[model samples]
Target: MNGLIGKKIGMTSIFDAAGRNVACTVVELGPCVVTQVKTEETDGYQALQIGFGEAKEKNTTQAQIGHFDKANTTPKKRVIEFRDFNAVEKAAGDTITVDEVFAEGDTINAIGLSKGKGFQGVVKRHGFAGVNDATHGQHNRQRAPGSIGAASYPARVFKGMRMAGRDGGRRVKVKNLKVIKVFAEKNLLLVRGAIPGHKGAYVILEK
Candidate 1:
């Protein structure tokens, strides 16, 4: 259940050994440092906390500095906990590269926040079909919900009714995405198909 935190470097098409055009999402992955190790006896769990992305030393607080000192690594912008230590046998200040986490054809789940679309209607958000009349006395209610409730039965609008409202901007997990390739030298991971979130957003890659 080990995972790595990385930034989405957008996506591109690349050819495999067979010369097939493979759709992929390029990610700038690890080189994340092992910050803290939780043990079974003390923390009641076995896990290693890794830090990624460097933050300016001037902006980092004293408490953060002390924490990084324990691992002998410079201040990081973000820190994520990964369960299980035996996966990499990582130590404090040790960098975890993409090669150590995933390989080609490895099945993984990419978790990230989807891009916000800002107040979308049900037709676009939840895929609800709208009124099919473009004419025939129809004016501007084409995108409106035709009916909401029963007349003399329920007498109230039912809960969980799909309506036009705020949309997107939520954590989405794309499961079973195959890892097409791994560029360890550039810390890049090319995954097949589209993933959630906008470019440069932080994404969690889990296997």
Candidate 2:
């Protein structure tokens, strides 16, 4: 899949040609630099390693500096590799813009880290419906996970049982999102509907 590294700028609504309001998520896509190019004969596979965003030199290691030096670019905050990108001809030190890869109405897949919701209960985490009402002896167990295991038959809770714990902050992929608009001048891509991650979080758009 050929794609670009971008940041989830925010979300907003836009009026379509039918004059209907549609919600969309705004993403600041690449202008990424080709840091390394892998070939089948040389590296056993083909892939394009691109770099995005800027990082301070002082915060980067000497080896990393040399790696970026080969591409004739400064330190980058985000580096990702895309395998089998046949859309454009590229080499080390090449620059890839969003317009060159995507257009309006194109369907794309977005991969990103979902927002972290610390420790959560079953109701919010697993969507387990609690006691229907607080009428019959159900005082404080409304949001609790009723029964976990059998008393003496199993003697212990089964593994992989849904329970209250840490939630979110994991890799998530949202597929089939339509590209409502593309702003080449600003390197912004307006994708229809919501995507994973919070504002400013890095996301990968694949076609």
Candidate 3:
């Protein structure tokens, strides 16, 4: 009962009880099916493997097909294992809805893959102010990452310097987002403020 698998369904603004307009991200919480249960004695840990979303049988591997078959469900596009889950009594193929886990005004954390911004310069990637502004005959120094290395001391750039390369497309967790509303019938959850990733991306909601 610590977390559930879900999808980011975009955003909407709602007026809260305080009459303030609060931005909320809409998430389609599970109706996740339990695919497997690992016990401490058997797997050295206790966890529940849950599956959500539909997957094509052709795209699903033979091994995965059999795994889903044992759960009596179709292949799932997303599978996540929740460790130390103990609040609910569930077996394989049991569907868990949003209302079963979350209530209004619950502060939770959301984990998702952030949108990728390919290789970039330090200014855009790390919010560096750049070398300097265009001044007395200064040319093309505004966006440059200047003075990366010392003249002679050390004779090499220090490792982990704030230089830019690839950016984004990584797992990001946004914490302390309060649950605004929950539509159990539609399996949707509304939380205050924005979360990571683009629309339709899978997100893990943790209590």
Candidate 4:
């Protein structure tokens, strides 16, 4: 397997062998169950549909319950399909753990939803300088996105202007994050640098 579904546990600093404090994010990786296996002839592509995290049977739909039952496992909260996983031979109802896929010193990518910052201005969202010193009779217009369009030739604002509306809460991927440590017993992965999303958010780790 080349990837696993995981959760962002939070961030912490750990001392490296060089005695330098390295900031890292803690992720709780999975013992994911293969719910479905797709082949080129069957689904027009080769992929594995894996399920992670626990879900109560009452909260799960009947179809999903049957799907999990087919895998001989309980309901899972997050299900993701990974293509081009040709490194190992796996079948439906197989379990893949994090330790079997990742190790320390390996580089991987993490994908998750970024934290939401609602209704922000260009100063915060687009990193505008914000009216320089806020002087020259500027009061509340410091954070305003000034002079968005021309008055004569181009009368309308352009479609792709960098003016802010909503910020974040979108899919973000952080690549080449070095794996600092992997605790197989606890199912924790310590990776250098930050990944997307808030605490307890689900993340996908790929190699």
Query: How does model 4 score by TM-score?
Result: 0.93
Local accuracy by lDDT, each model: 0.88, 0.95, 0.92, 0.91
Model 3 pairs in collision: none
lDDT head-to-head 2 vs 4, winner: 2
Write candidate 1's Cα lDDT for 34-109 as tens digits.
8888889989999989888989999999999999999999999889887775667877778898899899989999
Give the poorly placed runs of model 1, Cα more than 4 Å off.
16-20, 152-154
Model 2 per-residue lDDT at 171: 99
If both were scored by lDDT, which would come out higher, candidate 1 or candidate 3? 3
Worst 10 residues of 4 by lDDT: 130-139
Tens-digit lDDT string for candidate 3 (1-207): 478999999999998778999899999999999999989899999999999999999999999999999999999999999898875889998988999888998999999999999999999998988767688877888988778898787899999998979999999999999998999989999999999999999999988
Off by over 4 Å in 4: none
TM-scores of all predicted structures = 0.90, 0.96, 0.94, 0.93
Question: Model 2: runs farther than 4 Å from truth?
Answer: none
Q: Count the backbone clashes (under 3 Å) in each candidate.
A: 0, 0, 0, 0
Each prediction's RMSD over C-alphas, in Å, is 2.0, 1.1, 1.5, 1.6
For model 4, residues 120-152, the per-residue Cα lDDT tens digits are 989889899876656777777767788889888
- As a TM-score, model 2 comes out at 0.96
Q: Which of candidates 1 and 2 reaches a greater TM-score?
A: 2
Ranking of all predicted structures according to TM-score, beginning with the best and ending with the worst: 2, 3, 4, 1
As for lDDT, the candidate ahead, 1 or 2, is 2
